[model samples]
Target: MTTSVIAATALDPRTMAAKGAIELRQVRKTYGDVVAVDGLDLSIKPGEFVTLLGPSGSGKTTTMMMVAGFEDHTSGSVLIDGRPVDSLPPRERNLGVVFQNYALFPHMSARENVEFALRMRKVPKAESRERAEAALDRVGLAGLGGRRPRQLSGGQQQRVALARALVFNPAALLLDEPMAALDKRLREHMQEEIKTLQKSLGISVLFVTHDQDEAMAMSDRIVVMKDGRIMQSGPPEEVYNYPLTDWVASFLGDTNLIPATVLERDGNLAVVDLGSLGVGRVRDRGAQGEKYAVSIRPEHLKFRTAPVAENGGTGELTSSTNLGATIRHRLSVGGHDLQLRELSSDAEAPGRRAAGPVHVGWDADKAQLLVLEG
Candidate 1:
């Protein structure tokens, strides 16, 4: 059996300073009149790790390709190191790139693969071999340099690809879902490795991924894109904890979105009636008469001994499932079915056949209220 452990970390200010290396100024791309990226204005800092996170067809990959000089923009400029690179060719961009499908040369060994870029740059044979070996060593594949892509495991091959990209010490690195082929565990391990490598080398990285967890785990800042434009961009904690829009709230993390009308606002707090959850106080209240969205995370809800319905917090235990150290309970509340997660030490996992009117409650301060525009 394997036990997973996660350590808590404080917010790092250094992470914020590393945010704007590559700046996109009104960048847009169109494929035969079909717009892919519509005037995206994004800035990635030097030595910072930023991720372009969005679902499929969200213009994330297209943006990355434009930065890499692989795709042309219909309008606007791509600035690298504060200089426009719109007319520059891919070969002159000085950027490292890693794709999802490995993109390895099956006929070449890992060493040869890593050396390919250096060789193309006209580096001597001996120097290319030395640099390739050193790069492999950085990725923990020094001894496996002779192995071809077919000989290495998925994770190992990925490391080789990473090594190859980093070998050039380019101005910026572009990774388009590089770990998509690896299993969950290996993918996680590689994610950490990539983060550590980027930090130690002080290399700026613009990562493109659809996986929310991956973006949250590795990014210093996250740029959430949708329908060819940036929906939101901020530090992971800021984006996750304080989403400005309803779509941003739902996209970054697990949020129980409930509709509510803004009753009143005093400074940062807004008093809202959750319809069935009684009066709740949430942060970031907008103008009066505006319908707001109440965002509640599962961990914020607690189980109470009293009847939830009687207490005005509507809910009844519909089901419970044991998920290792945590127990998740399904509750039916005011025509809405929601999930509540309680730690094993805090709450016991109820039997499958157990019957009860479970009480669930959450502090008003824990909920986030967003002013709905539409």
Candidate 2:
């Protein structure tokens, strides 16, 4: 049986009345002298899905906790719909939170677990029951409401947790690595489900995760953090394709960073000398200097039939690895090692391995000039 893809559709404006915009102005969180989050200024428009992405101790989770009112910020304010919510309790703020561990009550049935939030809000018992069932249905657990947490699968228990979070019609949702506990395939499936639910409900969401692929898949915008500070924030394509810093470039994915000297600048492009490899033009962001690093994604480099004009280089294939859909090749060019990825369908004539003299080149436009970092 073929599974049909679910496309996220825009919700009606009336249905999204409870959606709230969140803004953090100069938000700072510190434990003694060590800062957890430093002067974070972020704005999440109503119905927007924004992700805080970083490695451990990068302040992504600390920032989320501050927004959820579970942790206090050292300075600054958190505003929801232009109103300050820094002093409000988590329940009073009407924010839904789902943690990495699906914190469902093991003793309670799925429906009761979902209904607990509504009961806390003083919702009528009858109405709470109705809402709980509806929430379960929304999460594809319609008939599983009678099951306990242990009786359900990991993904199902997570759905119950999600149902509990959404049963009260929250203004915004806070997800802290919600898929981290699941296996790889289930994690990917749940990512799509959460994204679909967020979009369908037109609710603003602040998702926190260290997985770059998860952030890229589910977020409308991604905020990359490091050492309690934001390294970069932008649409996934923008942040991935045009990172603002060397750290951002290196952290996001695999890329070949080659040190080169700037030869000339023309408009938005700069000609850089890659020493023995030759000269190439790359996108320049007003970086002034003779020395810079050119970041080129592995997929951008290819085996050229002949020497191209400005961006061609001679390299020897030093290593090759098969990665199912693609072949990863490490090339030694002018004393610098560069990684190249070729489609598996376009594998070299030698079947498994292709290690020998290879003409490696990439289009000048595919490279970006970055300032050398310490």
Best by lDDT: 2
Give the per-residue lDDT digits (tens) of candidate 1, residues 341-362.
8797877644632565656677
RMSD of each: 5.0, 2.6
Candidate 1 lands at a TM-score of 0.90
lDDT of 2 by residue, 132-182 (tens): 888777677878889999999888888888888877778888999989989
Stretches off by above 4 angstroms in model 2 are 1-18, 287-291, 351-355
Q: How much is the lDDT of residue 251 in candidate 1?
A: 81
TM-score per model over all chains: 0.90, 0.94
Give the local distance difference test score of model 1: 0.79
Off by over 4 Å in 1: 1-20, 285-290, 307-312, 352-354
- Model 1, residue 330: C-alpha shift (Å): 1.3
